[model samples]
Target: MNREMLIKLWQAHKNDEWPHVETGQEGPLMTLDTVISGCVVYVLDGEEDLDEQRRAIVSDCLAELDTLEIEINDECRSYFGRLREIGTLLLITT
Candidate 1:
C-alpha cells in the first residue's frame, strides 16, 4: 500500500473515524484491527529512517499489536503476515 494511504488510515483510526466497514472489510472492529495492524507494519518500515528513540517507539507500537485480531481479506492477511514477521524480528532486535 502507499505510505500516504497508510498514514491517512492510521490517522483516521486514531481520530475514531474508522473506515466504512461495509465498504469492503468484515465489520467495524475488523476494520480498525486490520488498519492498526497494517499501520504498525508501516511504522516498522519507517523506523529505518528514524533515530534510535523513534525506532524504539515504533517497536513498542509493534509490541502492542502482537495479539491483535486481524480480520481482513486473505490477501491482506498474507501481506500483513509477512510484514508482521519482519516487524516482529525488528522488535526483538530492538
Candidate 2:
C-alpha cells in the first residue's frame, strides 16, 4: 500500500476512528487486526503499491500490538484473512 495512505489508516485506527467498527468498548483502545484491516481497505481503495516503508509500518504496528498483549477477535481474524487474500491478488497482478 502507499506509505502515506497506510500511515493515515494506521493513525486513524490508533485514534479509534476507523469507520468499520464503532468505538467505546473496554480493554485496549486499538488492535493490530483492526489497524491492518484498515490499512488494507485504504490500500485497496487507493489502488496504491505496497512498498518497503509501507510494509515496515505494517510490521511495526503488528509488532507493537503483540507487545501490548491485545487479542484479535474472531471477526478481526476473519478480516485479516480476507485482506491477506486480496493483498496477495494485488501483489500478483502488480
TM-score of every model? 0.35, 0.37
Model 1 Cα lDDT, one tens digit per residue, 27-72 = 5335435544554555656644344664565565555444343545
Top-scoring candidate (TM-score): 2
Top candidate on lDDT is: 2
**CA error at residue 56 for candidate 2, angstroms:** 0.6
Q: RMSD per prediction, one decimal?
A: 8.9, 8.4
The global Cα lDDT (0 to 1) of model 1 is: 0.47
Which residue pairs collide in model 1, if any?
Answer: none
Query: Residue-pair clashes per candidate, as listed?
Result: 0, 1
What Cα-based lDDT does every candidate model obtain?
A: 0.47, 0.48
Q: Model 2: runs farther than 4 Å from truth?
A: 1-35, 70-94
Report the lDDT tens digits of candidate 2 across residue range 1-94. 4445444544454455333332432233245455556657666678675677656656665555454323445545444443344334333433
